[model samples]
Target chain A: METSCHDALLFTAEHPLRLRSGATMAEVSVRYETYGTLNAERTNAVFICHALTGDAHAAGRRPGDKRPGWWDTLIGPGKPIDTDVWFVVCPNLLGGCQGTTGPSSTNPATGEPYGLDFPLLAMSDFVTVHRRLGEHLGIERWAALVGGSLGGMQVLEWILTHPSEVDNAIVIAASSRLTAQNIAFSAVGRQAIMRDPEFRDGAFQAQGTSPDKGLSVARMMAHITYLSEDGFQSKFGREAQSGELGHNFGVDFAVESYLEHQGNSFLSRFDALSYLYLTRVMDYFDPFATPDATAALAADPAKVLVVSFDTDWRFSTEHSRRIVRHLEGARVPTSFREISSPWGHDSFLLTIDDYHRTISAFMERAAA
Target chain B: METSCHDALLFTAEHPLRLRSGATMAEVSVRYETYGTLNAERTNAVFICHALTGDAHAAGRRPGDKRPGWWDTLIGPGKPIDTDVWFVVCPNLLGGCQGTTGPSSTNPATGEPYGLDFPLLAMSDFVTVHRRLGEHLGIERWAALVGGSLGGMQVLEWILTHPSEVDNAIVIAASSRLTAQNIAFSAVGRQAIMRDPEFRDGAFQAQGTSPDKGLSVARMMAHITYLSEDGFQSKFGREAQSGELGHNFGVDFAVESYLEHQGNSFLSRFDALSYLYLTRVMDYFDPFATPDATAALAADPAKVLVVSFDTDWRFSTEHSRRIVRHLEGARVPTSFREISSPWGHDSFLLTIDDYHRTISAFMERAAA
Candidate 1:
């Protein structure tokens, strides 16, 4: 499962790329990592899109690295998205902080980090940048587009936006559009980041201060949604901290400690403003919102495989069902399944046998 | 459905009222509201416990009030728990902010608000205070003890603490103990309040400042949990805030606006320190953890009716099942039903036909 270092790809828009918010931006840079080799016909290229906080690192360990890539379990030499047969390219999304043109990227007009100056991007904007990245790599089409959660949102958008560019798509633990409850959670997460006085109106970079607490709180709030109640109870029950109760406001339960750790550790790698922008993209995502949703979906050319977990309340099976129903209504080739897993929405990222098996079979069929 | 003003009762403890945290305060003031008349046998009094964020107001309107009481739908003359047939008493919980001796109540020794100086309390402490309020009213035994959420927690505690004092008990949307996920949310809420630099380590009262944003965030988080996904989707959906999208972080979705309103309005009524204290009480609740759980349940002479909403993920039906299992295991009279409702944990407060009917039938039988 060895992985290589990430490669930065400059994608300067020849013309201003107008955003959904009616703004335009240019000179976008997208960083990506590739594993395996593109076949001579360039037919075996698989594009992997990342979730909200994910990066281009999808598998393997870097030099002197102790942690494997996030999806290492499914993207290694003989893994589900086997690198031996498929040339896998994982790109950090636009409006992402990790080695990508995002809120932290420099604003060419001002010679400073874009910060709040970064254009409000929709899921379509993210797909547009990734499409440019793909075309730059000399690929005519993607053999498959695979993603989970926010990444899955991109996969749905890609199939709709560039039908001929992708042959097969795997949308796992994702939604076509967020429900009101979904939007509510995102709103709170954004509020947590914005309310921190240290945010300095999203120009904390210039002020040399970080909204660490707010971002931490935001991450903690999101973390709670990522896992199921059973997952939390199993991992950290009412199990008292230090095997004894502390009557004060400190971490009294194991879940509190776990959430605190998740919140603190996330602050080191993620940008707060990027969190705001990316989550907004999720909130605005609604490919099915138009009047002719069926006709719009019917135009998608990819063979779609959709997966959700039974316990994944964050992006429940109902979300997957909605996508499948829409796809079926559009007469698209779609395979949908709700896998049973205790891990909740995070089951897609873990080493679950059924999860891997279902995707592997679907990928094989797509490849054949 | 009319209402009356609240009456304040003071109990100067000859001995300190010991808390689960091993601390004690002597002078305690309990503010309560009573409707209807006590029966000649003094057994027709129904004790109503309030949840977190709820006050002593349960039914009827205050002087010149436009809005009816919170539980006015079910606690009036011809309502489910008819005030005609039963006397009702609702009390502001210990450590509550609503005219009760709580964090905002002045500390006798220091002649200042207790703030964080208020001794950390447990569910047992809350139950103890209400029991005193009952005795002060000269009730030999309550006809029934009913509550929802934290109020439900108190109901369970009272049943266990004084088996003979309560004749019947109805626990709704409550848990015998807090799940790890439950504790996680509470911890984050407390963190939201505590991390606000303005909190001043809970000395905000003395400092003449309030952790308004933090408390607001906390309320918003809890508000999300109180309603089910179906509940939110139906109520708000993807409705835009202004029939158009706003590219900024201010409230955009209808749910966002609703949550923001809920959070902001909650700040005017709830105390940050009490939010911390009460949620801690919930986190520390673990009645089944003790070795005497079987003995404790066996000792309860009350007829217990436990109700849960199918859509209530916050305190799911599983929580109610756990309580019923324990009571049944101890050979206590227990009736349990998981009522179907789209309102989630707040179903108990809403006007659900089956829900009201179930409680009405049970209360009638208990009175009989």
Candidate 2:
């Protein structure tokens, strides 16, 4: 299968977009990718939300691309999401760097990259763009909104803010609210980026430099949280790169080399300002903290499926349990499962038998 | 009830110290603090090893100092270690910054700070300096060697390398070998410090600048691991610093402010080069990986007590269990416990009833 990115001007100066922070964006654009085909009734559309560091490339590959989409394993012709039977639409959420009007985009006023000038965004802002994309595609309601991690946060936001438009919501490895530890980690990552001399207060492009070092450090640290301890041990257990300790500051262990590579490669594709803004979105996410936050679900409630991985310490099973309890309390039809997987938070993207089966079963019922 | 740091020259050109990495240090000075009087026989001496970022001041307030030592809660006159009965001696380890000869120390050969020129060190090197300090204090054998985290690594090394000099060993929240995840965190921290432009390849001191930003970022990340999720949740659960989200790059959550404080406070007391070297010591520590690494214990075993906290995901109870298994395999007398505490790895330094009782009982028996 092949896939190509498509960009659309979702909001223009005449129709400025208002954000959750009470800030307004004069113009907004969305980059998205679609697979399979929309049925005549257009009731088979499934919206896929990407996680942190993820883009709109949910499956297949663009021409000349060496690797398939990040979640290619689960979205092929005969696979779980089964592209043959479902029209999957994945978009780069607001405040993203992947062909979206984000921090790296040009500001009409300054005619330079938005950089730090970009308004701080919230999950609601992302859902706002997603909803626009849905309307732009002429879809009245989504058959299912599927996502994990930050993407999962988007799904929850969609169900809570626009319950009438979401027929089914699948939130995998997400949290209704971030734990203190989660916020602490995100804060440190932001510190790494902002502290970099090259960051230059997020205007590195004008300086002809990038905060690669700081961004790399942030990515490397965050990557560790995405994988399980068991997964790391099994993949790279104190294995010396040269079969002996280097006895120096260089990479001695295989894990060190792996992390260094992860850090370095990330610099080529990600933006520093976008990272800072997106992580803040996750930090401030507390949809349930507001009064009657779930009250919208009481009427045209979306069927919800919350899935968590047993070894995913990042979100953990408790995060899923909390989501289930809240939805159940709101009288929303909800199903929950804690899938056993050693891949950690990254498990959501991998091809696990039970995880795929659970999603497949849920998608089949939702599409019907 | 009072303590003062004392510096002593432990090695000189005429008597250089050889390191496990085949390098040698011509001049080495150790900084230590002693509490209580040593018995006439010197058999009451108990060596205390401070963890990473800890100094020689292990208990009692130095004259005019505001706070007591880091472990003051468990080292008072009637405390667990009981200064009234044991002559507790705590020394700043090699590759440390607390008044010890380390990367910050001037090199006699060049009349400049060693910086990156400081030879890479291992756990064995830390043990060598510690052993020299014991001899300098005229103590033939320590009644017990107690330490936690990196300090705990020192305790394990002392027993394994010089079993005859150690009567008992108390290793708390330590790992016999770091898992890949542990190494990954350390690697990211080193990357953060090294990538700082002010770091100037670890020669920031010579350039009249400091990598305070990078060091602070590293400290903030490490501080999170030192604490348990529950501890963080109860202490700073998504609480806004100003009762409302700033919705900007500044500190928004209470946890962010708390971590920023931790990162900033650490800058005044810690050195980046020392952090790098000390963490490397942990990465290379796998005493039992070598053939018959514990062979020395068969003849002159040090009774061992390995303790782990239930919430210490940094070095979980599994790590302590591994230590116990290794000791028992070597026919060494060993006791193990997983104390319930919300403090995580820092639990080893806190005042927990069962934890203190476990240590007091073990120390009492060791002294007897």
Candidate 3:
């Protein structure tokens, strides 16, 4: 899944601006990576948005990393986000666990971590940066913009906020809004973080302490939501994990191992503030709030694709269609597909042969 | 989902004998509520095993409680486990949140709340108590022992430990072994409780303190795994449960509210120690340890009825089938059925119609 960075420069985007909260961030650095070389006509740009914990690194086995990109199998030389012909660009999301200016990033003014002090970034703010990234490359519009889960939300928000910035938008396993339940989960996570003695109320920037336990608990909670019972049961029922429960509460279940891995690993490259900021973004997302707000996107609706998985209880297919219905009602050229995957919402990260084919075909059309 | 329990009698089983672990136990007190009349032939007695947090009260609608017994729909006077026919007995499991002796029960020796000092009881211990309860009532054996989740574990163990104790067992949304993942989850819950300052290393007994935060976290963690993602998506989504979370991680999703309700109410009635014990019981459940273990069952082999819900990913129907296959191979009269529900592992508690019929059919066979 490795493509030469210098050779695969399909496009580049960057910008700096004032946020909705009246906070100005200058030269907001957005270092992104792309796949495939663009034609002279420059009409084949496909903007792929990464999710909360994702990065510009989408489909590759990067050096120094033991594992490949989150969805390397699905996007390679001839993979779904095929670099064979279509230009696919993936940027590290703003307020993310990756290399964008996030909570973990040093605050230029304070010379300290932004933590919660980082201007409260919204999902719209994320799309705004995305639009700027697209504009910096001198591209009038993208052939398509795609993402899954939270990434999917950015795609929907991108279309809703700047409908003309792209020709098509694909949202997979994304929801119309962050329900109270989702927020409650995020809140609990945040609570876990804030309550962590190390967190110091998000002001622990100077301490360089990561609220590992709190974050682990948060991730554990999120992990539970991401998979279905069929997935969890098939993966890890009451099966004993290890260390004999330590005669005390230690790690036991495979699920716990998985969640602990996610949480601990998250603290390494991810910022606690980024979790706070990004979760807030998801909580505030509303794809169908108003006519001028979201319904109005149809006037020049970007061709949109919404896909959902049957077993993905996290952001079920119904969520995908809700986006499609709004897109269609707005006279947007939209395609809706419901794929079946027993892996739950995480299927987007897995290369279901059918999913790959579908993505490849969609990219082909977007390129044309 | 309401019924009068006037005809039912509550029975307390003797807690005599040293448990599997040499611990001073008096007559095992099993505070059970029974419905329906036992026939002269004494062949109509049926045992109902309640889930982890369920109680001996099966089908009573309190004037202001608003919520009936979790199994009110199925165990009513004319319902499937109909009090009108087979004599039904629902016993408070050995270590439960209800009237049964749990962590909250007074220690006869210490004359104080047992709390964590309460002996760590296993699933087999629950079965032992059930057997004693049945014996005291002159019930040579049950027509069938019906249970879901943890209760199902008891039913399975009852058949394996004392095959003659139950002619048939209806194990629902339960498993034969504690998956490593489930153990890990329980580990986190235990950790959460232990970490709470109020918990004081499970020595909160003398202080009159309860590990509210830890217990709540435990409940919150467990609650998330109990439902299907499809259930969460349909029920919560990013919707502002009651018009909130537009900006914060507060209770913005209905799922969060539901989880909160579960977690909050749990701390009130549940003993954090019992939660630890019961989950461990689940962790220790392994019905297929050795074939010889089954060879000892009564020559007629107890009839086994295994049931699971399609949506119960926590305990997939496959898990139940594994039990059916094992019991049947042992020449135990066995039946397997997978009921349909969207409630995930908790489906048995909510969707009782199909199970009601299944239990009724199995009980009728046992009566005959």
Candidate 4:
């Protein structure tokens, strides 16, 4: 149940990291966490791709930490992920604010935070960094790649671009191509951040101010999408925060207070520029649009499992079905399931019986 | 089909209007538009309530105007509401921006725009002003009260508070109590406006600067909800604005471009203070929560038709169903219809064949 952090200098001047946008990073450092132990053959390693707003910490608590990882419920010894049998490695995404080389990182040339100067990223860039991290970890090939939401996008990208690198891919609540509505929501979030007076064109770091208001607004809005309407009704409903309406704009409903807390707490952990770049990465993600995207998977197809929550409007069951359809059309071994949960896109992070069982059964089959 | 605007001083210092918040408006004005002629009975008058962001104009083009009224398709001579047979009057709601007494209106006490000083309003306050407008029109009783979205809420309020005043009530795409998710969206929108530096504590008019960015962002987010997923997919989808990704953040996808256009265009027409007050009014709307809310309708019920579009996630069919259940429980005559449309909550505003036909048939029955 223990997890340890690992920071590796993955890319340097001699081995610069090239982004999908044609920009190169002279130095790239990856911060990751590992749970359990890799087997002797190094084939027992399962690459975990964290979703938006997620970090390298995938399971168990670090020293002195009060809470375990974000997905701690489903990842541990004898759990669905079964850390006892397989090693789990999660890295902060390439353009992430968390302890990774992202927009907040210092640019080697200017020695200032990249801010808006950072190269625009795509899902491919994230997969590229992930592959380098795998190589750095001496993982010749991953036994499996597992992820949900944005993480799920990485798993699909790996299967599409380098199927031979992984034996199994678990894509949960992810879309091969974002719907127009999805893009619109992400666009609004980006607009919120960019429009903040303190944003200073994403160079707020140099100005000693942050686009906290804008970032908070963006997070609050996105947080609403992460939960199901039924979930919200059950949890908050018309419940007044102080037993009566605030009458003014402070916080009348429990839902508003909850969102305010979510927004405020997010500012302390997330960077505004990183939010912009990472969301942009998801916005432009159109892997299936690429001609012959699955042609590579045809040769050494990875066993794929696409999972979606029934109530997940963010990336609905249709999104997973589309991914399954594409994989099946490519003659790849694929399984799809729509788990019943009231949690929406966030159900992937929770310990729902059916969802965990599906993953557990799939992992067992893949591992065998 | 001709529509002429009418502005009336509905309240004065001699007879001040009392608000739900116990505040008094010494002076209040109502802006409305009338289509067709009132019959000798006066009961032939049909009062139309406009939704959020709507104005007094409901049908026909005014002098020197390029566009007809908002509901021109449904309110013309031979259209759903049939102007030739029924005199239709559409009034701007109480706390509205378009020539109505609202948060943006001047407070006689302060001699400045009310802004945040505007009293917190409820659905009852809107209904109170609406009733005054009805009386001022010299109509003893309305043949029908028709509305959609927030307008629908007003119709419901009329049924609950003044059932004897209207023969029929058609409420479309409204909720008796906003779900937590609904409130969450409104709360984020308010946050977006309030967080803007230009807001200046809602006294932006005094400062000669508007929260244009914040208001635009709010509009962009709400515009997404006003549309169904299928509508966005068909209308904009992931199609690039310029046939290629911009790669940076300035309108890459067609949806983003469309949303930006919507947001930008909204700034010139809508007031931030009004947006705040009106959305708050909706958030606090819980008519059914009041004791024996439908008791007044028990004695002389207004024939009610509650309509909802299947694709409307904002106020889904469940909202309409809830209204019907409440009315039915109180022995009020009510009919319900779940119309299928790709337009989502905005479906009520669109001229869908089934929707129009349903309204037309109901109007005929109500007139009979």
Candidate 5:
């Protein structure tokens, strides 16, 4: 997907997070990229949350030309998120690399990237920032909050915490909470990132070059989870990319290339600190962790549409079912479907139509 | 489980193959471990094949140790494989770590480990070695050839190459051939090994310490594939093993500890040279590549029992289906089932009674 133009105003929290220290009360602002025209009513603002390694540069032209947009197929003129009629805003999360005050952001006090020293934030903190951004835009409520996987987690929390803030919530191929194993996976990733001596307790910003190896490994690990065994086999079964191996580990399968690309490119566009933060947000994100848990949350699934891919092992259909059960319990209008795909968790990014149409219909009802 | 030192009996081979490097051999020799006594007719031999890093220590008590065998409960006197009536033999493969002529084996010409200079082998080569071992043991045929994942791959190739050699083939959590993606994963592991400067082109046998980091990373990578997303989420989602990460990459999650244990312990027992050799065997295995092309070699699918666990992603159940479909087309007697498990590919190794019973029924019929 092409990235947006280089121009965008950024802001950070008045008080920066004091991570590693374990004390709270740290604040950080976010960097955001916006496209499409904001209507006079300001009622058309739609905030989009990105996947694990995604950024505010959803789509545009020429990769940085500032014309098209990320999620271009679904966000421009006549597209699903139709820029022609709606205003779209995406922020680099608190721990993201884009323009937000994340691990990559320079710590005002020391003028260094906050690497590991960034305060550990709850998933709700992300929603809180979205709320602030919404307030800054002078929008009382969101027309829709659309996201997939981790992004979907935000959408879920948004609807739950700020129930009246978003009119429609579209969560795709995402789970309601972190499973123990998912938490374990994230723990390993964080370990990988933290283990890289160069990580230097989150002060790697001045180093310019982050823990590319550890980050790549973390990405590679995450990449593995995003796909189902069936999907992985169907797409990349034991065939060497070149029928023969020089016997080195650069990547000998098309899938390895895909994973490597994901791992490597992510380092360029996303922050490792952000990666740790977001995964943590996801891990600590059990909507059913509180009073009465599932039953209580089930009664509060706000006008939601949950979509899952059969091939997505990360948030398999089972996760979707849990959300559906909650929504069904809440008696909130809900649509749940498990699309068959061999693309794994990535199915959400590629299959624009099925989901686009689902959301389109969903928004129609929400707006009415 | 504790290992027992059997009498160290020497065995014979059935199809002693000539080495591609030009050594003509009449029969192959085998050093093995057995459990349970053979029945009067000697028809209940259940041959167990080990995975890439596995040893011939499948079941029963060690010579003097208290720890049960690796596959103890499943193969003891009255266990599933029924050591009471069936004879079980697990032979260390040709390019294996345990008591086999592998990379660790000294080269006859140079009087050093085969290392990188050793001839590369395919899955067929490993199977051929196993066949030789079978012949040497005075065993005409096995009642059942049982294995999981890589071991399962051997089982599949064994039946394809010598269709009638084994009456029953129980392939668990494995595919007919490594998918391109599978090869890619293994390639990553191999790269981790050989890419290490210390690897010294697998000649690291003389280099004091092998590529421990690379090998550990490789093992970690493989370990992820061994479990299902559900299994991972249930076990280690993002929770810090220490409640808070010193967060760099030193094993923050219990899963990381588990993986590190696997990786580190593997290096202690497994020779890195053989690791490269055997992994290649798995990668080069393409039974269907030429078999589907040539008519004479088109195998009559032997009686096969292919089992898959819902959670085992390494050799996803879909892989099992690919094998079953090929066998079905070839008119080979095959039975396929997807057992429910959250353990992923490891389920094939962990699930006891269910898998054992499946093998029991399948082997009983084959012997009959």
Candidate 6:
């Protein structure tokens, strides 16, 4: 496996970024990491986009880090992504708290954290940032783009926004647009953060406080959506945590304990305001809303592969089907397969032999 | 349709009741409503159980109310349950706040509201109370027992604990036990309430406060689980509430507005403590956990019908399948059917023709 190191790229005032929400920000910077070597033609570069709550650290371990990166299972030299065969680039999206210019970032104009003042983001903005990052890395055109969930949404944006930049695009466990249920979940999560007294209108940083409870609640809710009912059954199965009920409002079931641990651990690594902004961006994503939308895009048939998990109710197989249907209607030769898995929406991140094989074969053919 | 009126049934100290959690209460009171008349042979009594957040008012409206009961659609004179033909009884569950003895009820020992002091409950406790109500009504057994969700759990208890009393049991969108996902959601909901400072260790009432925000967030999270992705898309469809994105955390999408409305409206009608207690009872329900569980039960196999909705992910059709499997393993004659609908877990309460027909035909046969 090719070892990777984190790198930061600064987009100075000259590269002032304008967001879809009619807001603009200057001095943008994105943190990214890369593995393997870019070919002489720069045609073997594979961009790996991260989902919500993910970062530039897609694979491999950071300095002194005992645990490997989030996507280490699938992104190593001998793994499905096969870093030895292709240069893999993973960038933390804008509005992310992980070494990216987000709400926690200082506003050049005010010399303070952007907080609520941070301009709203769209998936296109992330793609735009990625484009700048790609240009900085001396990659004019890449071999392929791959992402799952929010990252998948970004992959779609990259194809629609800059079709000629990549040869193949793989969207895994994502939707063309977030459905009402997705938005509703995001809404509750945002409301939970906003209603937390410590949230303080997304400016809790000034008070040196964190909306830990609200953010924990949000993560708890989301963590449930990421697992299948079968997964939950096989993992927790109504097992009591303390051998006896607390007989009060305390953690009684093993699932509750797991959720609390997930929620609490998330608070240590994530920013509450960024959770708000990023989830909103997902809710606002819809490419086909414009007039002559699909027709207006650079129609490149045989350039897209869509994948879904059978048990992924969060962004179920139907969502992937809808995306494929949209691509087909636009005359794009799209290949889609719903892989069987009990991991729900998180199947893309897990080690499923069939899932890995499909992705490997697809990537191999795309490279060929 | 025959007009119905609400009635209260009180059990004084002479009728002291013990609960499954080793807690006992005196002067326990259960509110109920009846439609039609008990048959001459006392054999046509049909008991309808309400799920979480439900009450004794299962059908018809109060004296001056404009809206009918929640289940009024299927419980009317000429409707599916056919109140005109069968004697129908609906009682508020023991841990419910709808004029029933619950966390909001006054504690005989403390003389204050039970609140956190209220003992935890199990499905059997609700059944025991209903049995007392039945004895009070001079009805030896019910011709049929029908319920959905938590109500379905209670119906299972009725058959398992007092098998001879329920000639027919119909479980709708229910599970024999909650899976990890269900418990995770309930855990988040409970944490939302408990973390609210106003909850004050469940003594909010004493401080003249209500954990409205926490309770509301709980409701919002549960509401998402109650609807299918298709149902949400058709209903809300990423429509912007203000004609444009607020670009802030304020209600931007129509789904957010709708969920906020639901959460807010729920606050006025429900007690936070009751929500906590009832959800715990649901989390604790598991009939097959005991040794000799199936053989110990007085097995009357020919009297059970398990109904599920294809789109109900909260208590998905798989959960219903599990219940049917258990029943079959116990040599119980059970009919299981999965009806297609886009309403998700709420299909049982919606105007789905297939769902209503299944229940109607099953109940009719059960009564005969």
Give per-model TM-scores.
0.96, 0.98, 0.79, 0.98, 0.83, 0.93
In terms of lDDT, model 6 sits at: 0.85
| Candidate 5, lDDT over the whole model | 0.70
Better of 2 and 6 by TM-score: 2
Alpha-carbon shift of residue A357 in model 1 (angstroms)? 2.0
lDDT of 1 by residue, A90-207 (tens): 9888888888888888898889888888888888888877777777788888999999999999899888767878889999999998988899888888887788888998899978
Model 1 chain B scores worst on lDDT over the 10 consecutive residues at B1-10
Candidate number achieving the greatest DockQ relative to the actual structure: 2
CAPRI verdict on model 2? high
Model 4 chain A worst lDDT window (10 residues): A243-252
Candidates sorted by DockQ, best first = 2, 4, 1, 6, 5, 3
Please give, as one word, the docking class of candidate 6: medium
**Stretches of candidate 4 exceeding 4 Å from the true structure:** none
lDDT of 3 at B55: 79
Could you give candidate 6's per-residue lDDT for residues B1-368 as a string of tens digits? 45554545556677678888787788678888888888899988989999998888888877787888889988988788988788999988887888888888889888899888888887888888889888888999888999999999888877876777778889999988778888888889999988887899999997899999889999999999898888988988878887776666788788888899999999988999999889988887788877656663445543899999998988988889988887788888789889999889988888889888888898878766
The CAPRI quality class of candidate 1 comes to medium
Give one digit per residue, the lDDT tens place, for model 5 in B34-136: 8766676667777898877777878766566566656665677666677767788987877676876666766655777767666666676777777766666
Q: Is candidate 2 or candidate 5 better by TM-score?
A: 2
Q: Which tens-of-lDDT digit does each residue in A125-230 have in candidate 5? A: 7787778777777888788888888888888877776676666788888888656556656755665666555566667777766666667777777777776666
DockQ of the two-chain complex in candidate 2: 0.90
Give each model's clash number: 3, 0, 37, 0, 55, 1
Error of 6 at A268 (Å): 0.8
Off by over 4 Å in 2: none
lDDT of 4 by residue, B170-273 (tens): 99999998999999999999999999999999899987899999999999999989999999999998788996777778887889889999999888889998
lDDT of model 6 at residue B294?
A: 61
What's the distance in Å from true for residue B203, model 5?
A: 4.6
Give one digit per residue, the lDDT tens place, for model 3 in A35-141: 77776888878788887777788767667778877767766677766777677778877766566677766777788877776777777787777777776666777
Using DockQ as the yardstick, the better of models 4 and 5 is 4
Interface DockQ per candidate: 0.77, 0.90, 0.24, 0.87, 0.32, 0.70
